[model samples]
Target chain A: MSGVTGQGPRTDLLAAVEQVRALAAKHAEETDEAARFPVAVLDELRTTGLLGLLVPAEYGGLGGGLDELLDITMELGRADMSVAMIFSMHCQQVAGVVHHAGPRLAGELLPLVAAGRMYLASVTTEAGKGGHLLTATAGLTAEDDGLDIDRFAPIVTGGEYADGFLITMRSPEARSAGDVSLVYAHRDQLTITPSGDWNPLGMRASHSTALRLTGRIPEHQVVGEHGQFRTVVLNTFGPLAHLGWAASWLGTASGALSRVLRLLRSPDGRKGANLDSELLMTRLSRSRQRLETVHALMRHTAEVVTRVRAEGDDLSRPRYQMLINSLKITASEECHRAVEDLIDAVGLRHGYLKGSPTGLERALRDLRSAALNYSNDRLHLADGKLALLDAEVRFA
Target chain B: MDARFTELLTPYLPYLGDRELTADTPLREYGLDSMQAIELMLSVEDTYGVELPDEQLTEETFSTAGKLWDALSGQLGGQGSDTAPAADAV
Candidate 1:
C-alpha cells in the first residue's frame, strides 16, 4: 500500500536457473516464428519448479518474490519473450490467485503449481473487453452453489498450457463491471478454443489466444470473493505484470548493451560511427535512469504485496491502487524506451535478419502489446494523475 | 564488530586475500545467491548503516575482513564507530 518497505520475496535466483538455460538454448526460433508454442521448454520449466516461482514455500513453492522473478524472467525474456510471457502469466496467476483466494486454497493450488502438476493462467482478455476487460459484456450470475459465468477473454497467456483458468466476470453482487469476480474455471469445465494464430511481429510464441467460456463455474472455482476481483486482479496484478514484463525489457536492453560493448572494443567492430559510440551513451544514460526507477517501482510494488501478505487487514487500498497503476504505466513507457534504444543502438543487425535475433524481435512485439494490457489507457493515465491529486481513490 | 559475519566468511570454501578474492576465497563465488545477498546486505546495512550498490558486488569488495572493512569504512563515512575500521584510513 503506502510506503512499501521490506525485502519482498526471497528466491535462489541461480539455483532456479540451471535448467531454464539448458532448455532455452534449444528453444528454437522456428517454433516461435511459426507461432507454435515452446512445449518442451514449457514442460522443462514446469519440471524445474520454476513454474511456481511466485508461490510461497509454505504453499509448496520456492517462496520467491519480485526480485528473483525479475532475474529469471529477464534472462528468459532475452532468450525468449514467448517463454517470458508464458511464465509471466504463470507467476501472475500464482501471485493473484494465491493473494485473492486466501491461504487455504492458495496452499492447495500453489503446491500444485510448484510441483508442476498443474499450471495456472489469467482469463482476462476480451475482444470486447479491449484486451483488459475495460469495456466488456461478460457477466456472472449467481448459481445454485457458486457463480456461473460466461465471457469472451481474448489474448490469454498460458491459455494453451495451463490446466486451470482464472477468469474475470462481473458479479451481480458488485453492481457494476468494475465490481468484478474471479472464477477458477478448470480446463475440463470450459471450452478454451484458440481464436487465431499468435502471429505477432515479436513474442511470436506467447500464443496468447482467445478462450471462449461456455459452462458452469462451481462455487469452489471462484478464486476471490464476489466483488473483490477488479481491484485484486485488474488493479493489483498490474505490479506483478510490471515486474515480470519489465524484466524482459531489461534483459534485452542489457543483452544488447553487453553485445555492443563486447564488439565495439574488439578490433573488428571498433570503427563504427553508428550506435556503438559516444552519442548512444547519452540516450543510454537516460534510459538507464528510467529503468532504474522502474526497478525501484517494481521493488516498491513487491514490498506492498508482501506486506499485504503478512498484515492482510492492515493493507491500504488506495495507495496500492495508485502505485500499482503507476508501475504499470512506468513499465509500458520504460520498456518501450528500452527496446527502442536497443534497436537504435544496434540498428537491427541480428534483429531484422531472416532467421537471426529471434529473441530480440519477439521482445519488441510482445512489449508493443504491453500498453494494451490492464488499463494502460490514456484515460487511466489521466485518472492516475487525478488519483494522485485526489489522494483518495476508493476501492470497491 | 559483529564477528558472526566474519565467521560466516571463513567456512565459505577458502579465499586468496589479495585486493580481491581468489577461487579459494572468492566472495562472489561464495554461493552469494541474489536472495541471500539481499538479506546479507540488509543485515549489514541495518547493522552497519551502509548501502551496497549492485556495482560493489565484485570479488575485490568482499575479499577479506580487512578489505571489506576498507569498503565498509568508505561507505560508512565515519558514522559507525567500529574502530578496528578506525585504524584503516581508507
Candidate 2:
C-alpha cells in the first residue's frame, strides 16, 4: 500500500523517504506475514543509512535532526506501519546509546551503525501470562564484555535480524535510588524464540515478538550509565520519540486519506459505485479537518519539545505537558480512525469483491498496531489534573 | 568557567538556538524549557559529581549566566564542602 513519496528537491531527506517507500513497497506482502520479518527491507535500510538516524554527523551519519527522522518515519509509516515501527525502535536505540555512553563508547558504536554492519532492537518490554510489566523489570550481571540478561523482553522488532538487543537491566546500585540499568547484548549470545505471532490488525508485519534475553553482555557492548538510565529515558528520548512517532502517525493517516480520495475521484468501474459517490465527499471533509487538527497539535508539540530540549522548565508548564499528552492521544486515535474510514470508503467490495488494492489489508494491520498500548482515559485524567494543579506539574 | 566549563558550553551552545544569551539576561525570556534546564543541570551534576536539589529549578537562580557563575562560586567556594548542593528555589 505504498504511495509516491517526495518530489520536492529542497532536501536530500525527500530522496531518502522515496528510498524507504521503494523498500517497503517491495516487501509489503512478505513482511505482512505474521511470523516473517522484513530482513530484506532492513538490509535495504542498512544500505540506505537510515539506521544511523540519531547518530551525529561527526560519526558519518546523515546528521538529520529530530524533525528529519519524524518526517522520514511518516513516509515509512505510509508504506507499512510495521517497518515504520522498526525504524522508530532502531532510532531510539541510536539516540540512547550514542548520545549518553560517553565519547569513547559512541566512537566505537557509531561506526557499526554508519556502516549498517549491525542492527539493534528494543528488548525493553516484557510479557507475562497474568500481567506484563511496562518495561524491563529484571536484572543482569556484569560479564567480561556485557551484562548477562536473564529474562526475555516482549515487543521486540528486528529481533531476528539485529546484531544486538538494547536491553534494560535492574539493580540497586547506590548511584541512584532507582533500580534500572542500560546495557547492550551482542546478538550471538541469545536465542530468538518467537513469542507467538504478530497477527495484529495493523502493523501485522511488525514481528514484535518476545525476545529471550538469556545471554551475555560483553563489556564493549555495555553502553550508557546503568545508574542514570531512567533519566535518559524520561528526559532525553522520551519527548523526542513522542513527537517523532506522532508526526509519523499524522503523515500515514494523511496518506490513507489521500488514497481514499484518489479512489473516489476515479471512474465508477464497480457496480456498487453509488456507495462511495454518496458519502465519500462528506467523510473526506471530516478526515481533512481531523488531519489538520493533528497537524496543529504536532506543530505545538514539536516546538515545545524543541524548547524543552534547548531551554528546560517548559516541561513543567501546563501547556507543554497537556500538549504532550494530547498529541499522543489525538494522533493515535485519529490515525486509526482515518484507516477505518478509508477502508469503508473503499467498501466491502474491495475486500469481499475486488480482492485488495496495494496491500490494503496490510495497511489496516499496521494501523492497529499503533492503536494499542494507548489509554486515553488515563491520559486525559492526568492532563486535566495537571491543568488544574496549583504547583508545577513535572515528574521530576 | 575555570577553563573546563568552556568546553561544556561550547557543545551546548548550539542546543540553545539562535538567541544570543548573556550572563545578565533572564533565562526564562529565551526558551529555557524545564527539560533543557534539567538536562543542563544533569550535565552539570555529572561533570561536577555534585547533585543539586530539585528546588533550584525555580527562583530563576542558576539559569542566568551571572547567577550560574555565582552559584558555582558559592558551591565551590574556598575549602571543599561536603553538604549536598544547596537548592534555592523551584
Candidate 3:
C-alpha cells in the first residue's frame, strides 16, 4: 500500500506556486471583503499545475511530496491566506487519498486532480461533536451499487465550491463512534444544503459554511480500510492541516511585516520629522525573528512528514502527534505576536486600514484565526498527555 | 513471535524491496530508523493485540526480525516457536 514520492523537482514545482501566489494576491482583498470563496484564485491554482501538488506523478500529478507541498503552501499563505487555506484543505484531502485510499479510488481521483479539474474538501466536524474529530454523528448505510451517506457536516472548509469531499462517517456495521470510515463523495452525487453563512473576522474568504449532505459512496471510494480514519487523520490529514495553517499564519505575519518594511523605506519613514527610524527598525527585526521561528517549526515538521511518507512508515506514533500539536500552538501564538509587533511599528494611519495601502488591520484579523481555528486549548491538552508519558521526545 | 506476524511486518520495512525478508536479516539493514521502529512497534501491538511494555521498546528487541518475533512470542504467551527454520518460521 506504500508508494514513492518526489517525482517532480523542487525548483519547477515552486515556479508554479509563485504564479498561483500572484493570482491569490490580486484577488485577496475582494475575497475578504465579500467573504466569498476565491473562484479566480482557485482557477489560477489549477492552471498553474499547483492543484495537483500532492498527487503522484504517475497519475499525471507533479509528484511532489509533503515537503514540496509545504513550500507551496507557505508561499501561498504569505500571499493570500484564504487561497492558501482553501488549497490546504484540498491538499489534506489529497493526502488522505494518496496515502490511505485504495488504488482504485486513487486511480479515479488523482487523474482529475492532475488535470486541474477537481478539488477535494474534507467534510468532517459536526455541530455537537465539538473538537472530537474521530467521532461521527451521521452514519452510512449500504445501498445497491454503493453506500448511502446521510450527514450534516457543520463546517466544510471548501464545501461550497469543492468538487468532492473526503467525508467521515460511521459504517453500518460499526458498534460505536470509534468505528468510523472515510468515504469519497463527489458534489454531483450529493445534495448539499448551505446551513450557515460564512462571516468570520479573519480568513473570511475560506467559505467554511455549514453543509448538509446526502450522497452515495461507491465501494471503491471508501478511503482507507474500515475503522482506519483515525490512523488517516492522526498520520496524514492532521499534520498537513496543522502545518498548512501554521504556514498561513506565518504568511500573514510575513505580509504584515512586508508592508511595515515598505513603510520604513519610504521617504516619510526614512527622513520625516516625526519618525523614530532606529526604534522602528528594531521592532521590524523582532517581528522578522518571530516569523523565522514559525518558519523553522513549519519546515522541520514538514521534513518529518515527508520522510515518513518516503519511507512508507506508519504515521500514528505518540511522538509525531506531539510534534504536530506543539507546532500548531507555538506557531499560532508566535504569528499573532509577530503581526501585532508589525502593527505597532506601522502606527495608526497606515496600520488601521482594512485593506491595502498597508493592510495591518486585516492581517491582524486574518492571523487571529490561527489560535481559534483549532483552539490551542485542545492541542495543549493533547500535548499534556505526551509530556507525561514521553520524556525524551525530540522535535526533529 | 508467530511466523505469520513476521510476514505481516516484512512489508512495512521499505528497504526490503524484491529481496526475500528472512527473520535473520538485521532490521536496521532495512532502513528502520527510530521513528520507523516505533511505527512497526505500534503496528505490531495493533495487529497482534498485544501491548508491548515500555522497557521492550529498546533497540535490542528490534535488532532483527527474529528478535522482534521472539519478543512478541514471549508477550503472546508462547504462540510462536523461536527455534524454527525459515520454512517453519511461518
Best by DockQ: 3
Residue-level lDDT of model 2, residues A299-328, one tens digit each, is: 667666766777655354445556777787
Model 1 C-alpha lDDT per residue in residues A1-396, reported as the tens digit of each score: 112233322334555575675576467466666877788888887888888777777778777666677767767765666677677767877778767785566665777888987777787766655444432357777767766667776677768877888877766654334556777877887765667656666666767777777778657566776656644644346657766766665655555455545665667555653544576777667656766777777667766766665675322243555566677777777876766665665566644444533334545666776776554785375344434323334432
Going through the candidates in the order shown, the clash numbers are 8, 27, 1
lDDT by residue (B1-90, candidate 3, tens digit) is 345676778866666678776768666545564456667877877877877764454445766787787777667665444554333322
Q: Is candidate 2 or candidate 3 better by DockQ?
A: 3
Q: What does the lDDT read for residue A69 in candidate 1?
A: 76
Mark the 10 consecutive residues where model 3 chain A has the least summed lDDT: A1-10
Runs in model 2 deviating more than 4 A are A1-10, A33-35, A128-135, A143-146, A172-178, A189-195, A218-223, A269-278, A312-319, A344-346, A351-354, A358-361, A374-396, B1-90
TM-score, cand. 3 vs. native: 0.80
Candidates 1 and 2: which is better by TM-score? Answer: 2
Ranking by DockQ: 3, 2, 1
Interface DockQ of each model: 0.01, 0.03, 0.04
Cα lDDT of model 2 overall?
0.61
After superposition on all C-alphas, the RMSD of every candidate to the true structure, in Å, is 19.4, 10.8, 9.0
Instruction: Tell me how far the alpha carbon of residue A135 in candidate 2 is from the true structure, in angstroms, after superposition.
Output: 5.6
Model 3 RMSD in angstroms: 9.0
